[model samples]
Target: MSEEKAVEENPVTDAEATPVPEAPRPPLARRLLRSRTVRAATAAALAGALLGAGTVAWRTDTLPLAGSSAPCWDSLGSGSMDALFGDRRTEVDEQSLHDDPMGGTGAYGQCRITSYEGDRARRQVTVNVRRLDGLRGTDAQDWPREFLSSGMVSLGDGLPGMASSSRAWIALPQACTGRDDFTGPTVVDIGMGRADFEVSPDEAPRDRTALTGALIDAANGVIDGFGCSGTYREPRDLHPPVLWDSTRTSMFCGIKGLALPAAYRKELRETRASGEGGPAQVCEAGYDSDETAVRLTTVTDPALSEIYSSDALHSGAPVKGTRGYGKIGGNRAVFKALCQTGPVMFVLEQLRPAGKGSRFTFTRDLLPAYVAAEAERIGCGPQKLTLPAP
Candidate 1:
């Protein structure tokens, strides 16, 4: 059988003979080119080897790679704010300015943009921020009266960093040193540098617009770069020594530490007096209705105890318990209550039906309550609340 098959295959023509089979596998070069993992690994190995040999690959940067140099840590300095001065083209001579732009400061830092070569005239901007020491609210107050025309700028809420700038007159030598008498607790004060002698005295300099603008810009830049958020606006509960010391405030009101009736609100005007009698705080009412108008005043009447005494009640202001009740006399139906607490006094007067006035009108309410209430509010202890006798 094998002889017959060989004889048949030999007789077959080369075309009819099955074509010799090619190699079972691809060539070494083809095999290598077809493999993705092998190609990538080989390329990486070649690159590392070249780098080790101090030879860089051509168009290496064009190749998409991950590793690169990182940035340096940012520096902090209140003086060298050159990077913040985007408007400053060329650096000129600089001088340190020292002045409390806002009055009553614990500490202050100031820097100036002495000179810069810009499209406009040689302008300068000074950025000054005075800390309030152990306080917080002054930083967010409106700009000083000097910059009254200038508006307020806020970096939104939560960021205490805010700024204000104005194009104000720099009167040659008079204001050459900037304002030295300004007062307040301002956190960020950015204004044009007044040291520049080339300024008009009568009117604001025309080129100073840029200087003022630069101050505002630089101030914001510093706040952003230095992470100065939540540092400017402080809404504090500033109260006078006595609530009545303020003519208009939460502490001073028509009723004893309480708001007046809406009808008498419009007429609630405060009047205060301090003299030989003592210090008295008062709130007088004004109304248009036929209803009675009340007048609440604080008097330093020296004879307060004597006048409010039962003996003096028949003649002058009368006293009953902690209050003195009486009429305003004549056809006017107004009654007055006097509460003298040591040296301080608060008087409450209520309007009544004409000719029918009674001192008990204010007795129902504790007119003298605030004498103790205010003392307590101020964290005072054991005040002489008992009324003094004649």
Candidate 2:
């Protein structure tokens, strides 16, 4: 009892007594939590960085985060896609347009859009932007068959373009390309085909009117991309597709006075001609639905006539007339004549090899008549062509 009383009286110093209850310390986890202000600042910084990256990606066309970029360098817009491709999703691959340095090829590039239905490919649309290389022999002979065919109609509104169910083309303005000073015409052409099988014009998925709009829109885009000023107007008066009709007129291919030769009359059953007024025109007649037996074509656009310049200079015997110069041979003839508009190309060709019994000769019998008739129609008349003596 005495010892306890003594210890209590001494009463451990205030600092040692009950250790001051350690001031009721908080839990370790609670102390480690950051303040609300700090958390908000960090979240804001992360969001800003993501947004910045997205903007860059969208502009550069490097990310699909914003969905497929306007196909074909943004030349193929939403409206065109809807009209041409319908509801199908499409994929695009392009080789950016580049001008040739040596000036032989001119500006050239291509874009392809492939539409898919589920996992299978359904359709393909090819867009080519290039100078029609008449000198180098690229697209000179084959281009007319598809782009300048009877099925095609003029783009109207004074545009130098044409459209069909499966094809369309437009020439870029001379003001933009200095084309008046250049050798070849820079052009944009589109062709469509069924990805899985062959398709007839009757079964074509697109129509001429829809295709015309797509063509004009794409041309406008190309103009803008080239840093050119002005845009083309969309036409409302597009003509209906040209149909193949039985050859009832004496004038083959709808040429007013050009007669269908007896050699072709018995065998060739049908004839087709391009739209009445345009930069180019074609008349074709064939049997068994082969429209290439005899082809007579005229290219009135001065820029487009370049396609035959080299051939006119190098191909057959020299053909000189008051109008122009070119070559005349057995099966093919190419003439480049000066016109009020510019140089024009008059072509007569027999697409197939002549049979042993064949009597009609295209270059000898048809070219002179064809050129004279076509020249007059285009208002470059009084063009008399003298056939070279055999």
Candidate 3:
């Protein structure tokens, strides 16, 4: 049986045992092309690439996404950015003038001029003018306006032009009655440089003229008002003389003189001589403890010191050292000082900041010469003239 095993069926043929030979692998490109899924995928990919390229070309050709406008692009011209942002600015022209609501009677004018002594770096003087009209009340309100306007406008336009320009603003109201009892005049004001002036119907022409002349004179020279003079003193002085007129303008000056307290007056009188600088009563008002007295112990004598401390406790003893405290709005302290000086009153205010001391010094030093020059131009007598309502 063993030998016969050789007769057992011949070993299986290699062909029958082994599997059939496989075809060679296809190239990557060929494989892609052959399969429907792969081919479709490739076609889709190509279409996407073409679309991207078209988009880029269109953007570059039409307008760049960055820096889309010119360097000088303005919404005002194109109305593009303006439309987006909303227009907020309005145009204004100098040719247009608004009509005054009060029957077109109100008008304004201004003038300014600068006097240069050297090159552009050096300026010797500046004058300004301002004028306003159509007011209906007290001269007090109008006087200040006229003064300031004439001064300010002179700085821009010459003094001659300022006077001429003011004429247009001088139309008076039709029959302004004193009985109207109105608050004050309505004024339209203009400014040139530093000076401003306004005039109501109430202001007298003579007063206006005087003020104008004074302002012009001041531009050329020196002038003082409201306790401020064209004069100045050395900066080192602790207390310099003030420019004040007790005889001319008495309202503020009188009030100032009477404000001293009694205690201060007693101290000043006792310490200083009677005539040296004692307070003197200038007005008709009677001085009695009942009317103006603060307390029995503390009094403002109104004779020695326009304002003084009556109580020895509150008198000279420093409140917080150099700084003293007094009743607010009361002139007891002032009166005490004035009583010591008598009828005359003085106010010493700095005309300029300490750093600009030179300007003040120059003004004072040249004041006499300036005043003389001003007298020739405007006449030296009183410029103000009072006239009854027409």
Candidate 4:
């Protein structure tokens, strides 16, 4: 065992230690021309760089985002020139379809017309008609399928409360469109929530007379469809509380009607004649200023009041002025100023419940921006963001 004592090996000295090899890097030009697995990669990258440079040059040579001018009436419906401009009903030629930066294609037998004015030449009026085809593809498709599938819900019924829910697209003028330049058609888009429907067309002595008559007829149609009874309330007056439920249940909903402003009166008349359920109530005249407007309409049920109030408070122009909640009819409210500048119409609808500690939540957080946009349409000032209410 002693004789078999092992021979041990020693570790290498520091001087004998092997060094690690360094990674190789190519020259700048070589790096730029380096090729990946694909042979055309270098060529593709070069092409992309040139394209990007061209785009930048083109944008710099063009108009600024704040002041650009484009055509307004490049598109018109096909038919006898008379059909497009005549009082008679006729089919719209599909080939004649054109893009309207301010307005989209009309649905439900609807047609749209837009006009503009000002140094910026902003769109001032937009007339819309309901067309069957338009109805099929418009925002109506984006609505809750449940509501559409159920048709009209009766206020008498306990669950979905409202007797019916219908949608009407409000043609917004190009001034209302969010484009930096007012070069599009004169019209903005709006949705009429849960409107009443009717099928009467009253006769009038003249075209203008007929248009006004049709507007009234349409208003009545909506009112009748909602089954509103008991006396009519003036635009500035409040209705009886008995007509609404104090509970958190569903109720019938509609626009907050307002008197049309003189500035837009003529356009409103023409819009009504086109048959798309006149302009949005909030967009009417008296409501067009920086001030706030309030009114009450009968809801099919009480729950609907919550929904409607929520929508109103959260909808329309964002509240301006103070940061804290304001009181109106014993309800907590927030204020927001809509359109600032341009020919666009603006409105602010306050929402708060009848009791203590009431608050309305907005559907989208960008509502303030939406309001500012509206203000810009009418050439108003910028919005002042405020701290949240306590």
lDDT top scorer: 2
lDDT of 3 by residue, 1-390 (tens): 112222323222213221111234333233222322122233344455422232110111112123332101000112311221123322211110112223332211112222223334221111221112213212322333332221112211111122212321211111210111212222212222222222333443332333333233222111111111121110111111111122211221133212323322321111110011111111211122112111101111111122122321232222211112222111211111112213111111122221122222322222222222222222231111121121
Instruction: Give the per-residue lDDT of model 4 (tens digit) for 214-266.
Output: 22222222222122221111111111111111111111111211232333222
Q: Candidate order by TM-score, highest to lowest?
A: 2, 1, 3, 4
| Candidate 1, lDDT over the whole model | 0.29
Cα lDDT computed for each candidate against the true fold: 0.29, 0.64, 0.21, 0.22
- Candidate 3's TM-score: 0.19
Model 3 worst lDDT run, 10 consecutive residues = 270-279
lDDT value for model 4: 0.22
For residues 188-304, could you state the per-residue lDDT of candidate 2 as single tens digits? 888887211225666553455556666766676666555555666666477765666787547778887777666566656677777577788877666645435777778887877
Model 3 root-mean-square deviation:
41.5
Clashes of 4: 51
Alpha-carbon TM-score of each model against the true structure: 0.23, 0.77, 0.19, 0.19
Best by TM-score: 2
